[model samples]
Target: MKLQSTLVFSNELPPVKKLGEEILLIYDQILAQKSPSFGKWAKGISLKYPVKAGEHLKDIEQFPRHIKAITKLTEQTSVKKLTVVVVGGGSVGDFGGFVASILKRGVRLINIPSTWLAAIDSAHGGKTALNVGGAKNQIGTFYPADQIIMVRTVLMAQPEARAFEGFGELIKISLIEGGKLWSSLAKEKQINSKTLWKYLEAAVHAKYKVVAKDPHEKKGIRHVLNLGHTIGHVLESHYELPHGIAINYGLNFALRFSVQKKVMKPAEASRLFGEPVMGFLLSPLRDDLISVKSSDLAEYRRLLLSDKKKTKAATLRFVFVKKPGKTVIQEVTVDDLLIELCRQREEELHG
Candidate 1:
């Protein structure tokens, strides 16, 4: 399937003046301080909305006020020629993409992701989302961007530690699209800007391949992309871990669960874990993060139910890997997930 958005790579931010005569720039406010060039460029825009990037920025209750302000900001601009350029990391991309999708019933959207996480994952999927009542992604639209520009300088400007946050998605896609992508990534010894940049193109294309097959995520084929997100989200919301860091733990949990369920052969699991890149999956703070107590079961269950991917009252389609590139989905109840979480926590504690 052909990708809806045109993908471009550049060493620096492109001239947004040429994108449209009337442009509404929705960007992370932090970029003004983080990137001088971005700050200078933003000053020239006639209509721009600078936003704080995070889960709170996606709160649905805040949407009305945001839209009203944006409406007033673009009141005189011609809708036909209006373009929304989003610049930021995942949460910013999510908020901006949601705004672009609804503003004037949609506009030409271009995403210039400033962080590796957005550039590699969120920026490509065209999944715009907003949270409601503290539940993540409760309301959203499948509004693909008109263009996705990955600026090298913008991404590299992020702190080196941010590379660890992007590694989860990078490894997740490589594992799902296994063969050359997996083989090459598995041998890498470092998780840094250079390594991420080297694999960024392949990782984005790998995601588009899955999304193209099931663009709307109606078909279960796209569920493969949720490899580590299930438990990952739980860890993220509960522990307040960075999305990528939480996903790293989530991927670790899923791999162990797959082996326990006999979905993946022990030899295969062993081989995959033995890879050099796999070492980066577990942070030094794993014990602090993965130690879920029995008292926390109620909260964990609540999070699992709140998941948008839940199929019935308490069951969700969980993605399990049999091997790199081969995954299986199974419907597991909330209780089932909690039991597994406790079991994993125990195993981590003892061994």
Candidate 2:
């Protein structure tokens, strides 16, 4: 499945105007209250599947119930002309995208990302997923939406706290692409929704560049995208942290590990962190704020192994940064990650 195209519009919802006659809108219920025009835009929608939207929404056990409801809701509509327009954050997009991919054996799908996190990262990827028990993204598909529409009002409507969430992916992309994005972004005095909007295009482009290289992830090229995601997913599942916030810590861990393992020059690592912007994104995480027992270490390892992207029996092709725009992938085991986690936690306590 080739990703069709992305339209990043400011203060407009232009793509929704041309939606197919039989539109099956799977939206976050929160949007109805948050977005002023959400109701108006949803006026003529054939079927509206309003979801709560979160990691819980991706539970595999709950999936059959959701799909069954959607099946009944769309039974009367013409599947050929049906379009699944998903409007929400990442989780809603994942659940809706998965629904659209399998609904009537694949239908035209569109995404109207309502959160900066979704607008900047997850919504564009074409990867749909559902979780098994507590494990994240265990089952999924590569179903790219036909179009991705980024509406300013909807995105801007998010709570200010949500900007912190968006920043993780925003910063991750900049660091991955490095060069100009890193230089300019690092100079910012403050990061807010506007800052996120300004770099939205570049971040999305950076992600697409990686995805295009290994769209199906058959080649190892795309594994670089998992820079912070390995430990990030574990923290998100174990600590119940927001995905973006968990990634912020995960990115920090990866950068430090890169330097500690002698894979990246200390000078290069210092230069990357010396940027004023790193101060906000690299602040101490909850892991540092709290103490970890051996039981916690065992639990963390269990969650880490459940990441679904491990290569060998207990190894992962962890992404390491050599410098801005330069990254290397190396085979790492669970024990290596555990040791680093403990070492990092100890350092946080001391310093």
Top TM-score hit: 1
Scored by lDDT, the top model is 1
Supply the global lDDT for candidate 1.
0.86
- What is the per-residue lDDT of model 1 for residues 188-295, given as tens digits with 9 covering 90 to 100? 998899999999999999999999998888887888889998889888888888989888888888888899889999999899999999988873224665555666
Clashing pairs in 2: none
Candidate 2: C-alpha RMSD after superposition: 2.6
- TM for every model, in the order presented, reads 0.92, 0.91
How displaced is residue 120 in candidate 1, in Å? 1.4
Every model: Cα RMSD to truth: 2.6, 2.6
Error of 1 at 27 (Å): 0.8
Q: Ten-residue segment with the worst summed lDDT in candidate 1? A: 283-292
